[model samples]
Target: MSPLVQPRLINGPYDDPGLILDFRHARRAILFDLGDNHALSARELTRVSHVFVSHAHMDHFGGFDRLLRLSLHRDGPLSLSGPPGFIERVEHRIRSYTWNLLDERSADCVLAVAEFDGTALIRAARFPARRAFAREDATPPDLRPGLVHDEAALFIASAALDHGIPSLAFRLQERMRVNVHRDGLAALGLPVGPWLNVAKAAVREGAADDTPIVIGEASIPLGRIREHALAVGPGQSVAYVVDALGSPANEAAILDLARNADQIFIEAAFLDEDRDIAAARRHLTAGQAGRLARRAGVRRMTPLHHSPRYLDRPDALRLEAEAAFGSEP
Candidate 1:
């Protein structure tokens, strides 16, 4: 079955770290970090509907200008969530640039920015390019801890980890996976079309079994479609973690947030031999990252954010992580 989310790294380990989650079931996409995003095409950039920023570090947020520029003419709103003080940082970033050419006639470059205070959303605001990106106070979502984005197919949960300051790690939790039974559809004399989406929505929304699904001509009961044409199963999850300290608290939080994830994009910032430096910088060593991934029981771990100190031995860091991943948890 085709997975709902297709996650790709924005840059290599030698560059800034980020992840882009493209929805196979939806037209839009979500971004994990606002790092250097030049790797994405303009079309793909415009498809991004949401962005989750871990922190305001230059490497993690310096690409905001590119995203903003690409989405200026797009009609859809661009929503971003991050740790506390995020709204102000985004405002300042926009304020620094002049918007003299913008006017009421221009396409709306709306940004809905929300700030999660490591628990709940404490602040939110809307910024429109036509208004010179001025801050307009907006209502915050009363979300529970570790949850920021909720939708029909999935909900995004975040954990705030310490790296001198709060660096967030996010997990995309899919509510359920429904696969179409080709044989059953053929038996039911159903043509492949947009009606399948309606059926899937009915399944995801838990609509009544007696609900009617409109085909080209006949209206069939949802219960018949569910029993014959749809196969329901467990959904997949993807986690993104970076710039977190290798402390016990962080380990616990990361392991929980990334637990049983199908894929985890984590930072292996340093080699095991340079663990002292990693501790000093509040970053993870390759071995530490691997062990944590193993303990989390993630199916796959893609390590990024390698330190330049090991430029001469790029393979050594990943090799160490591989070894540790195979070691006893």
Candidate 2:
């Protein structure tokens, strides 16, 4: 079967932790943890409307400024989500920069920041903060396991885990399903046109009616129109996890979020030989990261957020992780 989702490692141990997932067929795209994002050009950045940050670590957040700067006057609103202190961190970034250029620009951009704090959620915004902005806490929502953001087709879910501090793992799922049977359409002497829109609306709303679907003045029963387009397909899911120590207490929570992910991006800062150092620093060794991936039963695991010390020996680190996961290359 053709893969429903495609993931490109924008930047990683080879550079910074940036991944671009092309949900083109699903009518959306997602960027996970904006590290050095040179992999994505200005054109690609403009197309992405949703970004998920794993934590505030420089490698993970450094490219955010550039992303915001590039998309300053774009068409749609940008939605950013992360663990606690995310809103404050973003506001601090905006305040630290000069905004004269933003003010003069024609783009009226709005930043919506969502932060998860276990039982409650907080959200706020800054219009390219012109002055020294103080962090304001907004009304919190119940942070339970369900759809957090429900846009037209995009849905997001999050769960909190301890990383010496509050850290979060986010999953973005596209709930729109598109299906059509070519043979069925051919047999019915129906030419596919805008009638698909009515069928799609019915599917999305889960209701069917006897309304006549007029295609260029030709009428067709909604029930017959539904037959050619009614089919159920699987949705796509991508998970991002970073900077959490692999602990028994945190393992379940992390795995529960990562299990069965089509593409899982996790951190592997140390090798198994340095397990002690990893434990002391609250980072995961390559082996530990692989074990977690195996436990979560993910399809593909990309290990990132490497310590600079292993910069010259990245292959060694990668192999160590692959070995732990019983995978080669």
Candidate 3:
């Protein structure tokens, strides 16, 4: 099955931590953290429809201004989600700028920001680009657990971690993956075309078994297509975690949020030699990140946010992580 999200690291571990999740098929993308995102082109920036923040740390949010400027005149509304104080942070950024000279030239652009406490959205606000980005309180949804944001194709869940302040780790999972078997299609004598997508959708949506599926000159039941050419199973999942302390509470939260994740992008900001410093600064070390990935049973681990202290011995972190992950050098 084709992946629903194609994620790439925006910067090296020594720089800042950021990830770009390209949902190119949908013509939209999601940004995880707002660190130095200059690596992404203008077209890529404009494709970002939503941004997920891990915390309010400067490195995690420094790219907000760039994102705002890039989306200032875009047609679609931009949304931001993060831990508590997210709305205020965005509002403060907006207030820092003056827009008195701007008018209807860019009147339709809007920005929505939501603050989540664990899984519940505590506060929400919207800023209209045309109106100088003024804050407007919006109705809050009922307190929910597990899921913070939901979309038709996938859902995002969060868990609060200890960063001295609350930090959130996010998990993005597709609803379900529907794949078409080429052999089955060949057996059914159906040509591979756009109609396959319809069949896949039918499988994803659990359409009625007897639903008609037209292909070329003949019509077949959706069930026939499934039995012949469609395969459905659990969808793709990726987790993003950063700036979290290595503590018992944080361990539990990270494990729960990132459990069974296909890929875990976490902070390994220090080496085990500086474990004390990492703990003091509320950040994870390479060993700790590997331990979390192991305990969570994640398929793969991509450690990031390495501290500058390890610049001279970068391989040490990778070795430590690989050791904890039970992989040979």
Best by TM-score: 1
lDDT of 3: 0.87
Model 3: how far residue 302 lies from native, Å: 0.7
Give one digit per residue, the lDDT tens place, for model 1 in 156-272. 999899998899889998888888999999999998889998999899888999999999889999999999999988888999999988999999999989999998888999988
lDDT, candidates in the order shown: 0.89, 0.70, 0.87
Q: TM per model? A: 0.94, 0.82, 0.91
Q: Compare the candidates by lDDT and give the number of the best one.
A: 1
Q: What is the C-alpha RMSD of each candidate to the true structure, in Å?
A: 2.2, 3.7, 2.6
What's the number of clashes in each of the models?
0, 0, 0
Off by over 4 Å in 2: 1-5, 26-28, 101-105, 118-120, 126-148, 181-198, 204-223
**Model 3 misplaced regions, further than 4 Å:** 141-144, 180-201, 212-220
Task: State which candidate, 1 or 2, has the greater TM-score.
Answer: 1
Clashing pairs in 2: none
